[model samples]
Target: MSRRALRGVLGIALLLILWEGVARGFALPSYTLPSVSEILLSVWRQRQLLASAAWFTMAEALAGYAIGCVAGIGIAVLLSLLPPVRRGMMPAMMAINSVPVAAWSPLLLLWLGVGIASKIAAVALAVGFTVFLSALAGLDRVDRRTIGLMRSFGAGPLSILWRLRLPTALPLIASGMRVSTVRSLIVAIVTEMLGAYGGLGWIIYQAVVQIDFVSVWSAILVASALSLAFFGLIGAIERRVVFWR
Candidate 1:
């Protein structure tokens, strides 16, 4: 690893050490905050439980993320092709995004019930706006000079988009995708918290009600790990897709 990567690892290690020290030295009650070691123990002891919940949540998040990306990109492409409609649609998109997706969870749960569908919908809604705005910006942000040169070469709209615009916009879209990875997981969990038959969020809700703080922390740790893994996957794909950048 590079020095920067090493430093990040060291920083996380130090934080975990501090967290453990604070919880143990202060003699904090387990219900208040379990020590990092305790949380780890709980995680290991409850591996099956955590794994099942994490898998369920990951499936929902991935499904929703895929749907959101396709829909967002489709909208962006339509807007880009029909520039005149962009102006009219922009405000409406902004208006919808302004409302936090969590606020829609209750209604989603009521409509979709306490199954995976609600969580999936919540994740999709959370991720869609981000992908849409980023993709739209990417579609619109080509260098004027580069586009002029492409036009000078007699490159048509489709040719320019495939050969130039998309390449130029990939970095921005990748950034958006990276950001949405975490958001998708979070929204799914929060939605699950409201009402879910299974998932990490449901595990958390159960732990909370049972006053199993260690289990709670363990579930959170699992969720965090999943989010980090998802983010890293996106980063890797971004590196591959935008290799020049």
Candidate 2:
């Protein structure tokens, strides 16, 4: 591995060692704090639960991310093509983005019920503004000369969008997806914690309420792992797309 990668791994190892030593060496009670070993053991014992919950959470996060991406790209294209739409709606979009996900989760649950829909909606909302802005910026990055040349060639709006803007904007879109994937996962799990009965977040809530610190720590670690894996997948795809750039 590269030196930077090796250093990162070593840094993480050092942090984990510190955590283990502090918690275990202090002989902290299970309810107050559990050692890394204890958390790992608890996670092993609850493998089935983690697997099932992970599937649900992954589905919610990915589904919501897809929806948000579609909506953001569509809106970006429209806004780029029409000045009025861009002027009238961008501010409102920004305003919506400013609202905290915590405040939105309960309302979504109330409107959509305590089901997958609510979780998905929350995740989508968390990612939508970010993706939208990325896409808008991408569109703005299109070369004016290229656009004029396309226009001079008698290219229609759709043709220009498909042949020029989309390709040019791909890097930005991919960057947004990388960010949104992680944010969507966080929102999905948090919304699930608030309303849904199944997911890593729900498991964490249950652990906390039951005073199962080992389980709580295990759930947190699993959630972090899942988020990292999801982001890595996006990063991989991004590298493939932007390789020539």
Candidate 3:
């Protein structure tokens, strides 16, 4: 492994050691703070349950992310073509995004019900505005000189957008995608807490209600692992797509 990778592994190990020491030294209640070893053992005991929950939550996150990014791209394209719409829509989008994703959970649950749909919608909302801003900025930030030159050369609006603007915007769009991936997981889980058929968040809720702190910690660790894995996937894609940047 690389030096950076080794450093990261060491850092994580140190943090885990500190966590174990603190939990033991403080004699913390299992409900309040379970040790890493205990959490691992719980995970082992509940592997099947945790695995299913993780898969379900992952599906919701991924679905929502796809919906959000596609919708964001469409909105960005529309706004690029229509200045009036951009002016009118930006504030509303900003307002919605400013409100916490958790705040939307109840409303989404009310509308979408206590199922995977609600979780997916929440994730979409959480991920959308970020991607919208990035895509819009990417579409808007093209060089005026280049655009004018393209027009002088007889390039039409569609041609300019497809051939020049989109290429310029890809890096920013990819960056937003990478950023929103974590949000997607978070929003899905938060929404699941309010109501869900089954998910990591739902698992966490059940564990908490039963005061099964080990299960709670184990579920949380599973969620973290999922997010980290998804984040790494996006990072890899971004590196490929935005290599020039």
Highest TM-score model number: 3
Clashing pairs in 2: none
Q: Decide which is better by lDDT, 1 or 2.
A: 1
Which scores better on TM-score, 1 or 3?
Answer: 3
Q: Which segments of model 1 are wrong by more than 4 Å?
A: none
Candidate 3 C-alpha lDDT tens digits along 108-196: 89998998888888888878888999999999889999999999999998899899999999999999999999999988888888888
In candidate 2, residue 206 scores what lDDT? 91
Looking at candidate 3, what is the lDDT of residue 41? 92
Better of 1 and 2 by TM-score: 1
What is the lDDT for 146 in model 2? Answer: 92
TM-score order of candidates, top first: 3, 1, 2
Global fold similarity of model 2 (TM-score): 0.92
Question: Alpha-carbon error at 152 in model 2, in Å?
Answer: 2.2
Quote each prediction's TM-score.
Answer: 0.95, 0.92, 0.95
lDDT value for model 1: 0.90
Tens-place lDDT per residue, model 2, 52-164, is 99999999999899888888888888999998888998788788888898899999999999899999888877777778889889989989999999999999889999999
